[model samples]
Target: MRSTTTSASPLPPRQVGEIVYRPRVPHIMFSGYHHQPDATLETSRDLWWHTGDLGYTDEDGYFYFVDRKKDALRRRGENVSSQEVEAVLLTHPAVSAAAAIGVASDLGEQEVMAVVQVADNTELDLKDLFTHCDRSMPHFMVPRYYRLVDAMPATPTGKIRKAALRETGLTDDDWDAEAAGLTPTRHH
Candidate 1:
């Protein structure tokens, strides 16, 4: 004989808090401006929502998310901040601007990579820059690969177009040794 069983009825969703109550919650706020009040409140109150970011709260009540929620590089089980690495690269005198992205490594871990735009008529030394990072940032934060470009692709508002760079995959031919003071040899 065959027996049939009915699944239990689903529970009705509960309204824990109103949208206006987001500011009252104690949590870390990200660096970006919170313009969409509705979305922010929903994300904060939803239990299923993972902020997917690293952040902290101040004693007073202000919250701050330090790193990007997305685009975090996983290197040897560590989360490396691409923005942090890019900020370090910008400190170099030769670098006008930079954008850091993650590239897949042979070891199945993500490697930090940077695409930098140099100052007018100036060039960077890849080895020296790497040495600087070694002294300044943690090992996981240092970029494993570097690509020097004339200028970083940016949006009208000056935001770096990281998606475009990622789509272009890191090919050996993309490296500009001359711009990076690496013996002027083409990667290809």
Candidate 2:
């Protein structure tokens, strides 16, 4: 067997395990779910490492992440999944790629907005696309605003540039208002 070693100096010690918030330490506690009852650094019996992602377990022991604490959307008392909306848009034959973002609405809730890249030489009917969404997805999940572009802005690693999209609000200039003739119903 080949030996495994790092050429550089050893890195500083770091804690690993399931992280729990502790008010006393003003620091996070990490312990293995299957190993330690007390979160102590000296304990070395953990089977899993604590990730800083905020999550909790129910009484039945099912764990769920509460989403990124910073960039969560609050839409009419419902939490919208941007990823799920993007996935639905990708199913459209005309859409080559898509990104969904939340925009603040006048009704004190966020609205789903989509930026879609259409296939080359393909022109999609906006009304048909909206009809498709209405039939397939829940009403709340449908994008309130849509923008079509040649391609989506992406990072070096091929991730959609959500920050850039969020910075640019959904305005009439960005949309083909004539193509999307359906008027949006004003929500109170």
Candidate 3:
């Protein structure tokens, strides 16, 4: 069985659970939506404010930010990490930055969509990037949709706002591998 205790952390300890916000000082704990009690169904068990962030602790007691719980992709009967996909995409020579999001798919639960920014004076070839992803990662993790942009929306601290990208959804300029009739198969 997995240990219930977390690794020793300087702040609160590294936890592999929901990041809750609870204060020792007296304060009103916001329980649920303004008028919708049903919205707080998930918090009924613990009553702690869930931040929706998922992370883990290393053996030596270090906390690493994995991705947001909502950002996880269920693809081809497997859970794919968006951060891992973006990391692989960033390895491409033409790519300056990347964000991977899960989009609705006809074949499975969801398909990977990569929104990327190319290096200055560089042209992005969706085919080449797809080929690289196919060679570098698992077939299921390969992005089915590609969108190249001049810049990714980020915060002042330089964190990409993937939620914003997700909100934009697909555009006409975006390239779809399946729609384009390109088959990427895995060789067993």
Give the candidate number with the greatest lDDT: 3
lDDT of 2 by residue, 1-188 (tens): 00012212222223111333333453255334456556544232232232334344555555555433233455677665676677788899999999878887878978777789998888887776676666666667777778888877899999888888889877865553325665333232
Q: How many backbone clashes does candidate 3 have?
A: 0
Q: Rate the local accuracy (lDDT) of all candidates.
A: 0.63, 0.61, 0.76
Ranked candidates, highest TM-score first: 3, 1, 2
Instruction: Name the 10 consecutive residues with the lowest summed lDDT in model 1.
Output: 1-10
- Once superposed on the true structure, which residue ranges of model 3 sit more than 4 Å away at CA? 1-51, 55-65
Which is better, 2 or 3, measured by TM-score? 3
Score candidate 2 by lDDT. Answer: 0.61
lDDT of 1 by residue, 1-188 (tens): 00001112221232111111223454654623368877655444423333445444445544544465455677777767777888889888889989888877777877778888889989688887776666668766777678889878899999898888888877875553334653312111
Give the worst 10-residue stretch by lDDT in candidate 2. 1-10
lDDT of 1: 0.63
Q: What is the lDDT of residue 2 in candidate 1?
A: 7
Candidate 3, lDDT over the whole model: 0.76
Model 1 TM-score (2 dp): 0.64
